[model samples]
Target: MLTKKNSFSILAIGAVVASSLVLFINSTKKQESALPPARPNIIFIFSDDHTAQAISAYGSKLTKTPNIDRIAKEGAILHTNVVTNSICGPSRATLLTGKYSHLNGYKLNEKVFDVNQPVFPEELQKNGYQTAWVGKMHLGSLPNGFDYLNVLPGQGHYYNPDFINSKNETVRYPGYVTNVVTKLSIDWLNQRDTSKPFFLVVGHKATHREWLPDAPDLGAYDNVNFPLPPTFYDDYTGREAAKDQDMTIDKTMRLKEDLKVHADYEKSGIFNRFTPEQKKPFYDYYENKISKEFDAKKLTGKALVEWKYQRYIKDYLSTARSLDRNIGELLDHLDKSGLAKNTVVIYASDQGFYMGEHGWFDKRFIYEESLKTPFVIRYPGVIKPGTQINELISNIDWAPTLLNLTGTTIPRGVQGESFLPLLTGKKVAWRKEAYYHYYEYPQPHHVYPHFGIRTDRYTLARFYEVKDFWELYDLKNDPQEMHNLYGSKGYEAITADLKAKLKKEIIHYKDDEALKIMESKL
Candidate 1:
């Protein structure tokens, strides 16, 4: 059986067999490596002062937002989602760091954000994500965590607004702010690195103060007269903080500056922000026509207040219409680009606005209208369509939730736990009450700074800084917070329990100023 030719042939055949085995292993390895990562791309659409009352999915009858509602129709809606500060900058700061405003140190809009701090986007960037923010990142300093940024300076104008680019340069983009913001977001999606996952924030300045609609959207709700909220003339009899505030729809909402009386708000400089194309139509309808009619009627007191309410509600809803339309554009873009299947879309606001509740207009209180924010999210595979989560969610929990969504371990020192489980209807342990704090006051709205706690059925708060007063309400009984039960004879035990909870919450958040308020409770 042994021969030189036979031996050589056997050796060659064995070598060929070994080579084939190696090739197959290498091919399998290549295939496995070529698979896409499990992490989903995130599109966070954040709007300024867009209340759930205006969102039709949240059961608003005044206006219908088909596109924004589409997100809820197909995804999940959060009923008790709230913000830590209920203002633009602090809410954003909390969202970025997954921590309280005190931890982030951007407690109020007046402060500059410390860019050196670790943020969620920076963590995402480190983990191979391409992060960007398109519009209205109102934190005072330039954004540092994102790979790219085109943010609006300060509050941002409705038309021809200036955007601060990644290079610390402000560039003016001429268009309605909503449309321009959406365009930039789409443009970024087109140009972003396709191999890596992306996180894009399409921040909108719509439905904010002055409530200027797009030129095309003006007079949208002219036919419908929005009914006044039953509590529109809140006498503030029981709540002292409510009486001390100045953000009323009638008294504080300026006619020349806010309602656009003569279309020449040069002192506010909003009219100058508008070009001729915008000014001409705006003047013809709002100034020349509506103002003339308003003067002809000579309405006073309650009638005048009612007129402002109608005008205010119409313009606000009209601006919201444009916002929803642009949201539609982004949703469609996701669908056509094949990104929707693997991406997560979220719609939320910095905070909720009054929408004429309690005759007030601005945020900066721990009341339900101002404290709560709307949140709707869509994930093709993970979230089943039309899920509603009534579990309480705070803005501070945002970053940890994103990290958890990507299957990453949430970083240390992050205060908020991931709420991803809530989306799945898991019966997981969650917080019982939401803690709130507001520092900005005396300048803009004159609403006193306060810290408080909101439970499932009760709201307990302390209005501090100039005076000290405790407020308590059983939300089940007085859902509008019309009755303050503090110092009442029968509810001392309930008030004591809430105060204990508030102290724990303040310490948990590590807020030094609020700790003093908590100590004073003793």
Candidate 2:
């Protein structure tokens, strides 16, 4: 009924309206896209010889770690653990590259790592992230790929520690190692490129061997009498291989190896003639009541051994107290700076240490004390608060997970898988088991070099250097790993199956040298 011109005008008007609507929708999308996605600032705090059992959040009754506990309280606590090579240098190398010691070309303490090799920091930097590393990085070679690096040089001294900066210049900083490291980390955080995302690694030299605390913390646990571990006096009977090791707290540890007591030797009227340095060694010899009593009563042999255990626990926990306080300082910094909401905070140790467990102090064996490192992660907004994950994980997985969170691609030849899905509560399938390898052997502590696979239900281990031994523990039944069921009549099938899986893993990792030695021994 309408005229042809009128109908044409109507069609033209409809087209114009449709075009305007499309433009309006496109403009709204552009405004949304212009706003930046909230990328997190990651702060990874690592400690020396901090065992999971020492953390109160992990249900440790020995001491409370309130600051470290903050991370677990706000994020996920990973119960299942990983350590590719348990020694300090190797473990650190594994962390940097997400690869095993062999793959990273840093197998032992003295061995140097290739700086040219790819590391997680480099990848982060490439993706527009500002990276900084402060404190104890025990890798034999100097650090690379970091925008700012202030690291200790070779197990740096506790007092007046020397920190090597990125310019290859070393400067001495006064104060306890832990406190200085935390301060430097906070300084780095304040001065970083705010426009870009940042990744900071704050490494603390705490709770290490020869435990020494700040003067104020010296008397922290002086009043509390620590309860003896159930296996404190274990004879190591039926476990000849483990018994023969030299990691016992009683015999192997030295009094002079850890404590301090008197300020002025001569003024104290005890070893008065000795100089401060000369008297310092003596303080280690006789600080604790048991040690003093042993010396006063002239206790010998077995009686002397009993006295050492009591002294070791008190001093170790005192040092741990100082570590907790320093961590609290850093946590406070994040909160005050308004960074807590957008920061990803993590607290972990290089490897777990023995606190009189199996009557041992050092970590090297595939036992639970050495195998489980404490790991707690807090990613605001992304991770559910107060989450706890018992699934197996490794230090190697750290790199991939961080990369994934930053929306970066994980490179080839990395051994660890991305755990971001687990962190975000996504229902993605993850690894069921973890592999562990310790290469230091026939050396310190005399713990034989070993490799093993650990599953939820069992642990399968092989000690290659000594007797080609095989040890299997039914974790469900023997949580403490008191018994070895490798050749037991009732568990023959179980052992056989684990052995097959172990061999397959070794082959999969392409540890040709290890495989060759294993095959020759077989």
Predicted model with the maximum TM-score = 1
lDDT of 1: 0.89
Q: Mark the 10 consecutive residues where model 2 has the least summed lDDT.
A: 261-270
Mark the 10 consecutive residues where model 1 has the least summed lDDT: 262-271
Please give each candidate's TM-score: 0.93, 0.90
- The digit string of per-residue lDDT tens for model 1 on 1-522 reads 779999999999989999998999999999989975688999999999999999999999988999989999889999999888888889988888888887888977857889888888877887888999999988888757788999998889998999999999989999899999999999999999999999999999987898889888888989997888889989999887799888998899988778887666455567687777777887788878788988899989999999998889988998999999999999999999999999999999999999899998978888889988999999988888999998889998889999888766678989898889988778899999898888887878887878899999998888888778889989999988898899999998999899989989988888888898767753
* lDDT string, candidate 2, 1-522, tens digits: 899999999999999999999999999999999976777888999999988878899999988999889889999998877687777888889889999887898888867788988998888888889999999998866767799999998777666678999988999887677889988998888888899989999988888877766656655676776777787777765565687788887777865435332234445332343446533544564455435655576757766565566567777777788888988899899899999889899999999888888888888877777888999999888889898887888888988888888877799978899988887777888766677778777677878778888888998888876757778888889888888887788887887777777777778787877677657654
